[model samples]
Structure formats: structure tokens, C-alpha cells
Target: MTTPAKPTKNFRFVTGNDPDFFKDKKIVSANRSFVMFQQAKKPCDGIDPLKPQPQRVEKASKRCDASRPQPRTASIPAGAVTETPCPPGMSSDDALGLFRGDRRARKRLVDRPQPNQRVLNQILSLKAEDLPFATPNATDMCSFYALLQTEAAQGVLASRGKLTDGQLLFEAAYEGFMSTFPLRVVGSPHDTFEVLPKFKGDFKSSMEELKCHCSATFSCPNLGRTWIPKATSSKLSFLSTLCISAAHLDAMRGERSIWAPLMGQMIPLLRIMTADRTLNTSDQAIISVLQVLLGTMIACQEVSSNIHWQGLAQLVTLRGGLLQLDPVIAMMISIHSVESSILSESPIVPEYLEFLRQRRERSQPGQPIRYSPLYSNQVELMELRHDPYCSHNTYELLCDIYSLTNLISIMRSPIAELKNFQSLDDMEAERQSICARIACLPSAFSGDSKDLSRRARIVRYRFESCRIAALIYSNAILNGCSFSYAASQITPAFASSVKKDPAPRQNGRNTRSDSLPSIYRNRPVTITSYLKQLLARSDTSGLWGPLSGVLLFVALIGGTAARENLPVPTSATDLGTDSYNVKDRSWMAAVAVRCGVQLGFEYQGTMEKTLVALADVTRMSERCDSAVVEGWRASQEPEILEKSLHDGNGSLGNTSAPQTRFTEATTNEIHIERVSEGWPSTTGQADPSSIDWGFLNGI
Candidate 1:
């Protein structure tokens, strides 16, 4: 070592500076004992250690360890690819197939398919019972959040390991929430924001967006005639602020965290305050709590009425219904409550329904009948005498839905870019008007005795079920989102509002209204329970009448929507009182299957086609084939006829193919043909990755 070779620059210890690309790729030797990282210099058959020297250079045999027996050597091929290594594991064809993403690779690596195929093939359920509720995963110490912190806040986060300027993050997140999913009320502009009160003077407040330079501010109606009151934004407390921030984190990054100690402390304080009957909850505090609840729902991406909604309902009940609250607060509760009810299959809130009824009575004084150009045909549905099979208010709601659907369809076309409609305000007003109609109409029959034929009663019952199904259609297909938003803060507070006395407290909790069902005594009624009661009588054989198709649609929707981690009892004795009590996916699918068979549909493809059409949430402009023009022709009744109805250029029905594919459980050879109406029968799905969902936003 002392005689250490005076370092020659060329005589480095490592043979090459650049490591081989395939150096890490492990390959087994012939005996599978030794592993080698060697490239094939030339392709050949096998090795023969004792062979006589040949005239030509010998070929490189398959890699082998000392433990393997040798075979006859073969002549090296001049330009053969690294031949299938004779290690006897993994063929050349198989290696090539893996490199080039193919079905073969997918089959071999069942758990890990090729990247693109792998991602899309996963069956992600929208609503699963077993999927854990969204909880905060991030912490104050996370460097990711440090990016959002101020210098002072960053120092606090570093040294103290606490987030003090969380409001800054919350404000930023509120802006994002407003931009991403601004839940608009009726009479409001599309994709608008909740305006904050930027005070110009003492005791003077206007609907001016504060210093926030958010995109939602640009879209928001800044000055005169705002629908959402400024009070909503102004009253949000730090608790609500953190919640909104958490929701933003949940939506954008799929990661969430909150000030856990603060929350824990606040919960105890809230409990103590709640226990104190003298300490009445103010409107602002209630509003903040509502925001907190709403934020949690958003964070969870909730599509059903779970615990949050139940608590919210109870709080609203304590507050003497939506009317007694500030107008804007009422609107917030109404929108969330109504939409959640529709989604969860719960009964419409009585307060909202009564409010709509009063509005109807008030507007009846001078308002003239008006119909959208696309759905003048549904005007008759408004009259109880027009169709005994239809409920007057529900059918009226359905009629408006059709109009709204057509208007939205037209608005989504290129023609909308030209600004053909009166204005987005008018459209939203129309939608709000529809929301009010949904509120006014009962989701199911009153179960009151009526003078009608046996079949007529059955038909009317089916029609009621169809209305709720249509609500689902509107919530999912039309909105392209689970949440529905309606009711205007500007809607004048009703004079004779329901005023309930504060519930008498006993043993630390307030006594609930005794009139309500026992379900609400514990928790609010779920839509599943309501549906079961609604369908109790319809267990007999009877056509859903003219609305039979709609019933099928509803059944399909219920089945799909109810796909959750439900426990199925294998033994009959274990079938508890709850067994078959809930009309779950199994029940719903059975209903659909039976209906399909009764309707003479022999192919499972028919059901598949129906499900696809139900989920076709694309904009009409993007979906239409060779959409040269927004195809609407003049008609006397409705004033506009969809050219797709008459197959102009290419049928609009062709445009309604689903963006995603669902592999059918059963595929039948049977064909039952009768041209689809505004439904796909001739088109295939779009590329799953290319789906654009911007149409969901009204703007």
C-alpha cells in the first residue's frame, strides 16, 4: 500500500463511470441459483465445457451457474436479439408483450395491469358504507401547509408547531370553494359566490366582495339585487373558517387536518353552553354551525343524509324551522336540506314545502302562465283534472324539470355561446322556480282515500314514485353533481311563519316534538325507509302505467345508488326484522329485472343501455355528432323542436351515450327494438380519460 501505484487517472477502480441501464434488471442463471446482470453479446443455444476448439468463434451460451449441467454448444448468430434467456423462466414473447402494454400483460399481472388500463379498470363506488368517513390526515407540522403560511405564521409553525394564521389558509380555501363549487340559489347567477359585506361606512353594508380577488368574485353579483345576503359571508366564525378550509383540502388535495386541540376544547364548551338553557344560541352562532356542518358534508363528499344532516335537521328544528332564521341562513339550510333529501330518499322538509305552498298562493294573485319553448307540452300536467294518473303539483314539477332540461341542453350547445337565452338569471330563476315546485309537490301520495279506479290509483302511485326518480335524474344526470342548490335569500320572509316554543329541557337534553315519527325521535328519517313505506302497497302486479319506463329508470337508479357494504344473511332465520325491510340494491335490481322481463325485454343490453343513458351527463355541444348547428326547429306548441327528435344530421339520441362503460353481469342475444328517445342506441362511450365536467357548473 505504501508502494501504492501513483494514481493513473485512467486506472480508476470502477471500470465505467456510467452505470448500465439494465444493471439492476435481475436475471436468473440456468440453475436458478446464481443471479447475473449481463447483456447478451450474441445469441446461442447451450454450453459444452469439454468441446474441442472450432475454426469459428463459439457462441455465448445461456447464462448458467456452477450447479447446472452443460449442453452441446451452438454457433453464435450474428445479429440475433438478446434471445429468450435459456434460464427457462420468462419467454422472449412474454417479455416483449409486457414491454408493449397488451391484454397478455393485463392477464399475467392481474393485480397490476399496464398503467393506463390499470387506473380506469378500477370499480370505484360513489357511495360505500364501509368507506371510512373523511377525517383530517395532515398536521400543522406538514411542510406542505407551510407553503400557505405567512413569514410570522411559518415561524410559529416551525418553533411552536402550531398554526396561528389558519384564517389566512381558510380565506384562501373559501375562495377556492367558491370558485370550484359555488352552490347557487334560484334567481342567482350561475356559478356565483357568496358576497361579503365590504363596509363603506359605519352601519352601512352593501353586497361588495371584500378584498378577495378570487375568480368567484368576478362571477359574483357585486352590487344591486344580490340573491345570497351579505350576512352569510360576514357571520362565518373561525370554526366555520377551519371547516371550509378542511373541505377545500379534502376536495383539492384529498388531504385534510384541523386544529384538533381547539376542536376538542370547543366541543366541550359547546356542550356546556348547550346544556345552559339560559344561554340561547344566536342566529350568527347557528349560521356558523350550519356552515360547519355544510363544510363537513362537502369534505365527506356525502351523497346521502348521514349524521351531519341529522344533526343539522335537529338544530334547525330547535331554531323553529328555516323561516325563523335569517333569510340567507334559511336559504342555505333549504338548499342543502332539499338536495340531501332528494339524494337520500328522505321526505321533503315540511317547512320548505309549506313555504313553497305559500309562495304559490301569493304568486297566484297575478302571475300569468308561462312555459319554456321546449316543454309547452307539459302545461297540461299542472291541472289535476288533466290526468287522474298524475298528481297536480308533482307533475307540474316534472313539467318544469323537462323544460329546465331542454333549456340547459340548448344552453350547453354552441348556440348558448351566442347568448340566446334571456339571461342566465332568467334560466336560474326558472330553475329556482322548479326547485320551489319540487318543494311544493309531495314526493309520495298522502295515502289519503280518494275516489279513483283501482288501476288509476296504482297509476297515480307509480307517477309519484316517478317524480322522486326524476329528482334523482335531475340531481345526477342534469346537474352532473350530487348536490342540488336552490331557494333565494332574497325571497321575502313569510309573515305567518311557524313559531314553536323552545322545547322543555329534561335530563340535559331538550325534548323533541312528539308528533314526529319515532325515527326522528332518535334520528331523522332516511329516504330508504320512506321508499319502503311508499312501495309497501305496490307489491302486487300492476303496470306503472304510461310512466312504467320512468319506474324502471327509478328502480335502476335506486339499485345503483344503494350499492353499499350491506350485510346479506345466508340463513333465513338470521333474516332479522330489517332484512328485506330496506329496499337495497338486491331488491331494486330484482324490481328492474322483473320489469324488464314483463316489458318483453329479452336482452340485458336493454338495461345496460338504460343505465348508460341515465348517466349521460355530457354537454349537448360536445356530445352531438358533427354538430354543425344547434339543431332546434320552429314548432307552434313549444316554439322549438329538437332536430334530434327528427334525426337531423345525426340524431341527438346518438350524443347521449355514456362517458363511462359498465360491464353487464349478463349479456343476452335477444333484441327488442323501438327507437330510443333522446337516449343512446347507436353510439359508444367517449374515452374515459377525456371526460370534461365543466357543464355541471351553471356558468
Candidate 2:
């Protein structure tokens, strides 16, 4: 071998004996074999065989010497390059060709649409940026926008025609305004009244103003009225509506803000109306204002203690002082009297009874009469006593007066009954017992007879006062002015003494005896007996017994029938603090009788009658037909039990059937058989066939 000639630097050729050439050839064969093996494998194995392998030949032609090196070639342009020959495991024009042909394959992928085209085009189409400039003038722009909104809202409303949501929204807006801007800078009370009509703005303005005003005012009434009829009337109506709205809004919001403002305005108004005589308002007006004020106060959630309830108390005090200034108004004062007592949670019965006691004492020979500013003149205010309207008005007023007085007395009754206990222990026990009794007392008992009686005495004084008030009002209604009549009713003589009794200098013993009733002389009485008597005798006849006769009885016998058998205890100690006050006893008496009678007769009786009627109907149906009776009887067994025991069964009957079975022979049969067959010999054998057990045993 001419030793294979060395190849030049730029030329190479493969020789049959070369190592790289042999390695290349082996790899090519191995790859071909792998292809064939893959092709022969199942299609499920996911391989293709018989693919051609690319032949690796030296850049130089095969005619070159065996040891020649391959020359390097310049890179081919991507587009100019023809497809590479198939490798041993890959076919020409395979999956790679199809992948390369796809134009999108080499381009960048995006998660969303392109910003410049899709998103920007969509945004431009919306024209959102043009909205602000569409209406350039400030006011005009606002107005136009509002109009559009209003139109939109109206369209919605029209679509849902007659729905409550719109109305509710309107109301809420109105309420919010009233709450915020309660007080306006009106010129005067008259101007304040005038401002009320301005609230009815057009729908759009109304809603906006309402929202603004509610934020501004916060529910306080503007108290500017000077008690002029028109002014007062307007203010009252306005405040009433405002209060109602505030309460409603607060309730809806579940807040308590409205109460503070309402109370603030209401208290001052009540005090001004009650105390201001220069205002020259009628008793009806005064009472009406007071009533409304009180109702509002009660309905409010929070109340301020700063308001002068004490002043209100003095205004309604029956015996003397402020209430005495006007008799017709005094009658109206009874309404407040009851209200104050109830709000104070004090029993009014004792106070009224004490007044009665004092009155009785004053009528005695040696005792001085108690004087009140109300009874100044010997001549009664003719205007108050006999007015035609007075009777009816007094009736209604008395009902409320007595009702509240009775309620207070009942509420304070536990303290009232404590007076009769002997020891502290006993008193405390009784107190607890009373507390328990009061707890057990029906809510219906609050205004019954006993309670009414304590209230009645006060009512009687009120009635007398009303008689005077009615007389005054009648005079005013009839004559248009009754200053002389009003003055006469409050003249010096009448004001100095409540009753006509000579001062107690003549008979000391008789005066002392007549001062308080015999029963109340030395000891306090049990409240129960006093209450019972009061309940039994609260009618008109009992209340309005002749004054002269009562006076005469007190004078001559030194005891008035009114004080005859009060259950007052012997001493102050006996009358423990817990004993029912006269007021409480009176109230309890009234409530007990009223509730006991009404509820006992109406509710219990009606329920019993209903049950009886049902039973009778059921019985009649069962008895009228045999088949029905049998069916009914059968139904009664389990059906009745089922209905009755629907919730749960109680207990079963004693005679219910046994749940188990047992079998056994009697001893008498064996004896009888033995006797019939002749007795067996002791220790001796007996014939087995000789036994007559079957016949003897009667099997």
C-alpha cells in the first residue's frame, strides 16, 4: 500500500480503514437498526421505523487518499438552504417540515388582544372622555345632569308604577331634612309657621333639599311661638308632624338621636304654655298642649332630666298654688295630676285621702280649715260650675285622671301594704310578699276599683274644681269674657279657707277625734280591707255623698262616715313604711274589682262556654246514629289518644293486656287421679295401668 497519501488542509475523504470512518459507519448501522426495530413495534407504542438516515460523507470526494482530513464549509443562508438529507431515524419532509411551514410558530405569543388595535379601538368607541365636555357651562351642566338623572329615576319609577319604594325614598329624604334643619332663621314665630309650607318642593329639588336639611337640622323643633292662637296652632301641628317623622326615621335607622332634640323643644313649650298667663289661652288649649306634650315625651326614647317636671307638678297640684289660679284650667289640671303621678311612679291615693282627712278635720268645732288659693271667694266661679260642656269634658278628663292615678297606686302598692307589720323582719317579709303579690298581679289590675278610689278622692276634688272650671269656661263661651267670675272664684275669703269651718278653739276633744278617722287614729290598717271597701263603693253615689251630712256627722258624732272603718293601724310603728299608701290602696281596690269582674266574667266564661259547646256538639253527633256512634267510639280509643298524646304520652291504663304467655299443670289433678285409682301403697310396687289420671284430672 503506497501508504495512503495525506489529504491537503482544505480537502478530506473517508477511507475504509479509517477509525472515524468506521465509527461513523457503525453509528449509521446502529441508527438504521434502531429505526427498523421502532417500525416493527406496535403503533400503540408511538414510533415509526424504516426512516432513512443521512449519510455523512467527507467534503472531499471519495477518490481522495484514505487519510485526508475534511475541509470546513461556509454557513448556508437559512432561506437558500435545501432540506437536510434524512437522518437514520427521521424521514425527509416529516413533522419538522409542517412545523416550519406554520408562519405563527416563530412569532411571539400574547395572553390577550393587542393594545393598539383591540383594546384601544374598544376604548375609543366608548367616547367616555367626551362626557365632561358635552355640557360645558357649570350651572347648565349640573342642571342637565340632574335632569338626566331625574329622567332616569322617573323612568324607573314609571316602569314599576305605583310601587312603595319611591314613596319610601321620598319620605326618608323628607324626614332626614326635618331632623337636620329643625330650626330655621325665621323672623318670628309667625314666620316659623310660614316656613312649613315651603317643604313641598318639586320632586328633584325636594329630594336634594330634604337630604341637605336632614343633615343640617337633626330633628330639633324651632320653638318660637309666643302662644298666639295661630302661631301656637301652627307650631304645635308642625312640631307634632316633625316629632312623628323623627320617631319614624329613628326607628328605621335603629338610632336614638331624635329623642334628645324632641324632648328639648317639647319641655320648654310645655312649661311656657303651663305658666304663661299673659298668653290668655283657654283651659282646653292648655290641657290639649299638655296632653300632646306628655304623649310625645312618653313616646320619645331618651329624656333629659333637666326639664322642670317639678314646675309641671306645681301647675297641676289640686289644692292650691299655680293650678288654683284658674278654676277652668284647674279641671284640666287633673289630667296633668294623673300624668305626673304616673310618670313619678308615686301613688296619688294617699295624697288625696290625706286631703280628705284634712278637710274633715277642718270642719270640726275647734280645728282650723285648710285654705287653698283656689277657694278665695265665698261666691263660686259661676262660669266653672254649670257650663253645659263642662259635664262631658269633666267626664273624659276624670277618666284619664283616675286611670293614671290608679296605675301609680297599683305600682306603689307593695310599699303601701308594709305599714301593718309588727317587726322589721315581719315588715321585710311582708314587703317581699307584697313584691311577689304585685309581680303576680295581672297587668289588667293597674286601673281597677281600689286604684280608682284613691284616684277618685282626687277626682272628686277635681270634679269640684272642674265644676268651677266648667262654670268659668261656660261664662267665657257664653259671655266671651269672665274675668270677674274668675276673680270671684279666687277671692281672698275663698283663698283663705278650702272648707267653711270655724277655727278649732271651742271643743278640743271633739276636734282631735274628728281630725282623722277612728280606724286611722292610733294605728295603720291593712291595705287589703281598705282596698276591698273602696272597691265595693266607688260609684257616683258613694263619691258624692252630701257634704252637709258629712260635716254634720263629723261635728256631732266626731266621726265622718268616710273615715268610719279605714284599716289604719294603731300606731306609727304598726304602720310600717311598707303599708299601702292611701293612694295605692285606692288604686289596687279599683284594679282588683275591675279586673276580677271583667276578666273573670268575659274571658274565663267565654272560654268555658266554648269548650262546653264543642263537647255537646261532639256528643250529639255520636249519639244521633248507631254507625256514627260506633265509629266515633272506635275513633275515640286511639284517635282521641293520638290527638291528646300528639306531643307525648303520659301513662297507660292499669288493665292493659299482658305481654307474655305461661303454661303449667295443677297439683290437684295428681291428687285426684291417685284418689280415683285407689291410694298407692307406701314403698310397695303398684300396677302402672291401674292409674286413672286422665279421667281424674278432667283433661
Residue 159, model 1: lDDT of: 47
What TM-score does model 1 achieve against the real structure?
Answer: 0.27
Candidate 1 per-residue lDDT, tens place, 66-179, comes to: 255655555433222234333334544544445455436234343331222221121111111121212222221123233433344344346433333332233223322111
How many clashes in each candidate?
A: 2, 68
Cα lDDT for residue 375, candidate 2: 24
**Model 2 Cα lDDT, one tens digit per residue, 97-198:** 443463334444743322222222222233211211011222211221232234444454465345344232322222221111222223333233223322
After aligning candidate 1 to the native by TM-score, how far in Å is the CA of 449 from where it should be? Answer: 55
Tally clashing residue pairs in candidate 1.
Answer: 2
Q: After superposition, how far is residue 640 of candidate 1 from its true place, in Å?
A: 54
TM of each candidate vs. truth: 0.27, 0.20
Give the local distance difference test score of model 2. 0.29
